[model samples]
Target chain A: MKQWFLGIGLITVFFSQTVQAEIVFVTLEKDNALAIVDPIAGKLLKTIDIGQRPRGIILSPDYKYLYIATSDDDTVKIFDAETFVEVGQLPSGEDPETFALNPKGDRLYISNEDDNLVTVIDIPNKTEIAQIKVGVEPEGIAVSTDNKWVISASETTNMIHWIDVATNKIVDNTLVDPRPRAANFTADNEQLWVTSEIAGTLMILDVKTRQITKKIRLDIPGVSADKIQPVGVVIDKQRRWGYVAIGPANRVAVINAQTLELEKFLLVGQRVWNLAFSADQKRLYTTNGRSNDISIIDLENHKVTKSIGVGRFPWGIVSKP
Target chain B: MISRFFMNRFLLKIILVLLLGHTALTYAESIQVIKIAYITQEKKIPAALSNLDAFVQQKGLIGAEIAIVDNNTTGQFTQQSYELKKIIVPVSADVVEIFKQQVGEDISLIVSNLPRTQLMSLVNLDLAKEMLFFDATTTDDELRNKQCQDNILHMLPSRAMRADALAQYMMKKSWNKWFLVMGMMPADQAYAKAIKRAAKRFGIKIVAEKQWTHTYDARRTAQSDVPVFTQGVDYDVLVVADEQGLFGEYFEYRSWIPRPVVGTQGLVPTSWHRTHEQWGAVQIQNRFKAKVGRWMGEQDYGAYLAVRAIGEAAVRTKSRQMKMIKDYLLGSDFALQGYKGNPLSFRAWNGQLRQPVLLAAARSLVAVAPVEGFLHPKTELDTLGFDQSESACNNLNKETLPVKPLLKGTYDSENANSYQQIIQQIINKIKQNF
Candidate 1:
């Protein structure tokens, strides 16, 4: 029985790392276009122009479709991943800024900034099922690994609203910093790390208690507190390291998860926003909006290995095999 | 008869000797020693002084002499102008008295970076006749407005100009519905007001305005508190005027409405950033980082431009004289060479330095100002700050201020310039000024 338990634990760890390493990056450019880049090659393979300000993009769990929220068009455009062709478009809540895909890829939770609502869409049917009202400026959407809960960060309210996936009802809302822009759960789904861009700090919340267990502050004075702005966050499943994008600073901060201490700062390109890692966890790519390029960092070296020029105003990156 | 003859010859010789001595004295007086006094409390001032000294030495200006007095010292150095003395006071007046006392009546020019009040005192000095004051710092509009002095030449960009450039850009985006978020501090209020004025001038509407008491409001982060402020709001963009490090960053992702964020957190207009490599930004960034051992900020870029402006003016006029430099700077064709694009000139209506503003999305350069479509009745440059036709300044000193022909045709008066044009103009101005 002891041998069996040990074998199961080892297999879980191995599979988690494997899944984390083989991720895909779906980036949005300033011109309302999407560029899919392969992490291993450090090259952009396809560029899909979606109409009228495309942002907050996510891929289906099966890696078949890519869904993008177009703010100006007020629709979510779907593309066939392999062929890099548009499949269809569905109406999302107005001004959908960011979103999260369900574990099984059956639903997409979108944070619509203009309407103060979180819209749920059926991935297969390509239709909006329900719209749950939340705090003002809903952004930073994420789904729990178990697919039981959906979380949306309301920037104006400084709160995180948790929704029960099955019932589509508000479960709990917890206060955070001035502007909670991004959030992601730990591998085990025990904790969630949310980035408060305005506060220049990261809030770690207990998944069960829904209370902030730790507030990690960034220390880089001389730059304005506004410049220390934190945006997208990604955590390794083992919870050993957390990578955060400091927007104004245009750098990625690698934090030791256990100690919450900032370990290293890797300089990327201008307006560095989001990240997507390779399947092997050997490479990380960030979209730099201002520089109009993608910064690729070698995870092992913890430095920018190369920068690949992409479309205008690149934001939000995702990687997949 | 022999004694009388010897006495007469001796007297003649003595007279000759006296005449030679008088000639030598006249020659010595002709070679004037231009004495300059430098006053500052900061130790770094001396280091900067050394750089200037090297330049002067290289130029073989042997007749010039510099004397530095630490302003932190007691009144030991206090004195009014003595004969033939020139005083250069750092942004402080405590040392002004010392310069006056040490070099009475001989002061030619007063070089200072002092506040308006301190500068006013020196301007009012009875003994400071023919003394031209070169102001390196003071950005108070009042100095150029009500307190306009013939002797004082302002250098830094006024707050109004900065606000106007940013406002014009926002208006261009058709982002008229402003959610004005200001800090509780007085400076923040002033900045916000400037932005408000610009918005109004450009026909942009301020839909909602709120003052955040950031310090004492610990409950700002409370989930219960979120609904109270943002429950119902209709605004296109959030304009933050927080200079005291208040709620600017805290307002991100916290808005009650779902709209693209702008102003302080979302998209910001600044003078310079490290990632700005557009146009000549890379060269400037590299040179500045090499000199300072760090990346350049807006303030650093502004300071560098101010100094470079003086240099550019000197080169244009082919003289180090202040009047000639001032004239060249006011001339339309006078362009600053380094970081800023094109040549920078002063607005005829106000003495504000006309430069372009940059849109920095954090450390990266999002876009250069004077964005694509902004047109002016005069030149595209007018899109950067207050237009000449609408300017309050009449240029009373136009005779002394040289005017060159406009480089580009005036923008269409009937059609409004695009937001991108306005941004580009601001950016061009920054480059020109820098």
Candidate 2:
């Protein structure tokens, strides 16, 4: 096939550059594989067989292991990041879509979307610690840097469940815009940011007061606001910029971190779902689900520099140091 | 249905825990409960058609109850709960007194599944002025036109919308020539009128038109009647107008000419169907089936949408006041996701909820409309229902007519009064083109 030849040609062209770049892991959702990309060379270095419906991919705080949430198998498989071989497995609940790592680096808060529960796993013991019942279709899990609070955003209930990490119980809940998809705490833990996919608004909550400080509507000149579904978000504290992957709009909205103002809508591949920043935060990699490729963006240039073909329906991404 | 009644109570608690956070258990006792009343007439169905009916004895009442459960599931987290006061009045009974006695002064929102005549009578009562009624049953166009009730918000699609939806799908397939068949019923006659209007609007030609005057006879005479009934018509499709299931189903394989049947027959246009399994509809479907033990019908969906609208308004506004909720419902920002792939809103000119109609066959979904290429300046859904610029419903008061423009932020901040006049002229120009 022409596509196969095109991919091989791209790999050869990419191999001529620096070959010992940081590895970027991308979840090939439909292919049941995890692709390792050499970011500096812009080549897919290798792909390891993951389980069925592998969605969320993240590295441990010490970067020793890679944890992948295999939704269909209902288990988080831990792989040795260097050798790319299976090392361990965590007990994830039914249909785990995503998970968050605590700052202490020994706890995993996993979101079981179908079960409507946030399953907490003790990494050292490799056992389920607690199951905190949340709202319907809980998708996003974010843990505060202090490891005091765990927040889970539900898609159907359209609210963020604030769980006290000490008690493993819901301390409070705050209603956001419709179809809340993802939540993240600011690096300083001063504020909490939540994305409402259907409402197309990024809501910021004051951490101390737990009140909505700002609601920023994402709009591109040519793109309809209805199609601008804000799903994945990653904030770079150093650069003072937050990038939001607008689903189906094929663009990442760059926002000024302090002002919460949308600065630019950088067009990427089709149906961009998730994003990741490199160790130096110099480049951003995005998983274009529909286009079946990963777009590498030079953050300094504020444009997509190159696109490397991945597997079918690439969903989540993470970068190695 | 009877066995599931007790099961629903236990299931609802589990659902509440699953849908609401653990806050529901901690703050269970202190939550504020918003009361909603559901009023429907207890009409008898013909014994012949009873077997085919999907609804249990509760029908629309069950849908309202399911929505109340959902509301409470979300309500617990917000320190708000919901209660349903269901009233099923006997046929030919005084609905106004039943409504007044059941609702009293506590409930401000009423979900009505009554007949058109009963609804009209109830809406005329002095007590109805203070309450907002959600019409979930009737598809009568007059309610959105000549008999438009300011307090009544329609959840079900108008007959015109259904016809237009089918017309759009038919137009997409280039099935321009139609053979119109009508059953001898008053509701069928109104549906035929709607179809005719849709045909004219969508540029379809009615090659032949006929009426089904023959009654359903078990004596084998009905079979002889249909072949002759559908003869001599050379049309691409047969559009049947049968509100009640009198004889629409019999025309599928018995027609003289081999053509597709649409409208209320072989491939029908509806607000909801069992086969519409897209855009998270399956979640609601599974929930409804678990509680009601039957496929969710159109009437059930209508009632579900009505209660969900009230729930959405209450949740969004965080207020139980009737005035605030009413303003929010009629305002621009009040959009409800009715599992129709789009956020459904209301038409300001008339109180009709603008939504996409489902074109479905018996076993699967056929299409959803407003179809591709049917463009609207504002929303594609506006192309299906009566648009504000072209509707005959001029019931909106002139003073408050500018409310929509103000809500949409389309009016010029400077020269507000002059812009109202200019907007009127622009609307009139749009009417001429339609």
Candidate 3:
């Protein structure tokens, strides 16, 4: 009996460690700092500042480094995830707003807003591999799970350019709502969701068919009109729930992922920009620019659990493990 | 213990089956029906209804239903057909308050084809909270200017936009000195005032001003006419503003004027004309004549476009919800398959629908205005109304608004550039130009 109880205790310890793994790095918007946050306690442990206006952050699948698109300085800053220190910086196209890293971490797709071009960066050597011309004012970018296609939203054209990842050429361009600011693929990889800020609506396009399947209108009064802009969007792995950040309203709209029904507004700080979830999926964090704080929401209750002090003008958020 | 576990599993299976069945039943609920209230004159009801009916049928939208309310007849169109609910109250009556009282939660949208004063009454009610109002008539600039409302979607072009188009064309010809001749009527005076405002903006100097009055007396034509006085002024253009058709046609080839005449007569600016053949106008004109069984007029096109805008919004959003449709219409890249060049979109600053103004000579389309160089901060198309930086509305956030610096140069110089070069230069020059 003693031996059996000891074995059970060992298993419990292993399970808890796996569930509560520490966050390896946290990317900052202002100083381009990658702070090593103590994930278990949710505290900022250390900070390493890099390039200018660092945004659109993501971690390599291998958990080696974090890549951030520094828009103002026109470079992509790479930092070692373990040490939270700047490893290298890659030159990107002009006014790089958002980017996507290839599944193998071999190539980076960056959307250049001012230049109307998508720059492909080769990862190992930190060099630009190719530059493909796209429509006017390309802002948001998302890569396919299979690494076959990279889609970027062109704001002025009101369309999404689907580029062939291998050839670095535009394969297809599909019309979407006006001023499509952000885009993300569903977990099942069947549908692409785009948010049009001026249109004040969310457009869902079928990935395989390349056709708009549905356009869901947000009902929040002040948030659905002139300046009521809808910006960031994220879908859960199970495709059960989706969340979108309403820029002017300063709140995140919780939506039923399957039905596309707007559930309710989860109030955050001023000028809510982008959102990301913790690895355990228990907490959701949003970068509120005006408040200069990160709003932490308890996902289960759909309420603001805490507002953590972060860098000035926090614009983008990404979780690292 | 094994049997108990199996029983629990069986119970869970039963509950899951029942839940799925209930969900399917809920999904089978009927689609929401959209109710539209259409208010117009008795004479115009039959034509409007038939056109709308045919359009709805062609579009395959089976859910929308319209209720016509005619104000001219004693009994409304509502009484004649079961689908209609009520008639629009008479103009002399308290129609504004009546509409407010009668507009229930069931009404999704209101289509009004009424006079200017009547339309203004409806606009004053602020019915945007309950229903969306589509104004098919009323060319009053105030409706689109100081009296502009969030809920009101204008179908007709304002007087200022039309006058500005003509003024722009005149400016292109370097016709700076204008002989302004206006009638005694209120609309004529207002139109003349609008013309003078445009002349000032486009650098056209009003060299002389004259007024004509309609009279029943024998010596009226000789006495009321300003031809003798106008001939003495040194002017490059003659502008006549006559609403009652009093002195409009007489000003065309009068002995006094050696230059081109514009405004209400010789070269007038309008929304649509029969001879407009460029940029897919021929197709629209042909289709409209075929559908309506008559030559297309400005009012007819305006009415048709209002409905078409709604249809386009519905098709794009894939829903009939008023709020969604409204947002979609106001969004950038909203192209209307009509007379306007490229696609028509709402100006983000003033909420005015940006469109190419048509200048008509007699019954033929002559030119499109803003005549090139009359530039706004953001777009050349924005030169029609108030610029964003100059707008007096305090509700908007000035920080996010684009500050377009005024483009300088005479209209003649602007008309020199090729179309492609202008488009290319516009795209390149703008900081965020699309």
C-alpha lDDT of all candidate models, in order = 0.63, 0.82, 0.66
lDDT of 2 by residue, A192-302 (tens): 888887778899898887778999989777665456778888888663988999888899999899888889889899989898999889999999999999999899988
In order, what are the TM-scores of chain A for the candidates?
Answer: 0.89, 0.93, 0.88
Model 2 native-contact share = 0.06
Ranking by lDDT: 2, 3, 1
Candidate 3 DockQ score? Answer: 0.01
For candidate 1, state the interface root-mean-square deviation in angstroms to 1 decimal.
22.5
* Residue-by-residue lDDT tens digits, candidate 3, A214-297: 888775753324335678898887888888988767889888988978898888988787888877677777878778777788
- Candidate 1: chain B TM-score equals 0.63
Model 1 lDDT per residue over B161-196, tens place: 556666667766777788787767666776776778
- The candidate maximizing lDDT is 2
- Expressed as tens digits, the lDDT of each residue in B266-344 for candidate 2 is 8999999999986558767877887767888888888888888887777776656666667767777776767765677
Candidate 3 residue-wise lDDT, B331-360, digit = tens: 653555454543456654444556678788
Native-to-model Cα distance after best TM-score fit, residue B146 in candidate 3, in Å: 13
Judging by TM-score against the true structure, name the best candidate. 2
Question: So what's the TM-score on candidate 2?
Answer: 0.79
Error of 1 at A7 (Å): 41
**CAPRI class assigned to model 3:** incorrect
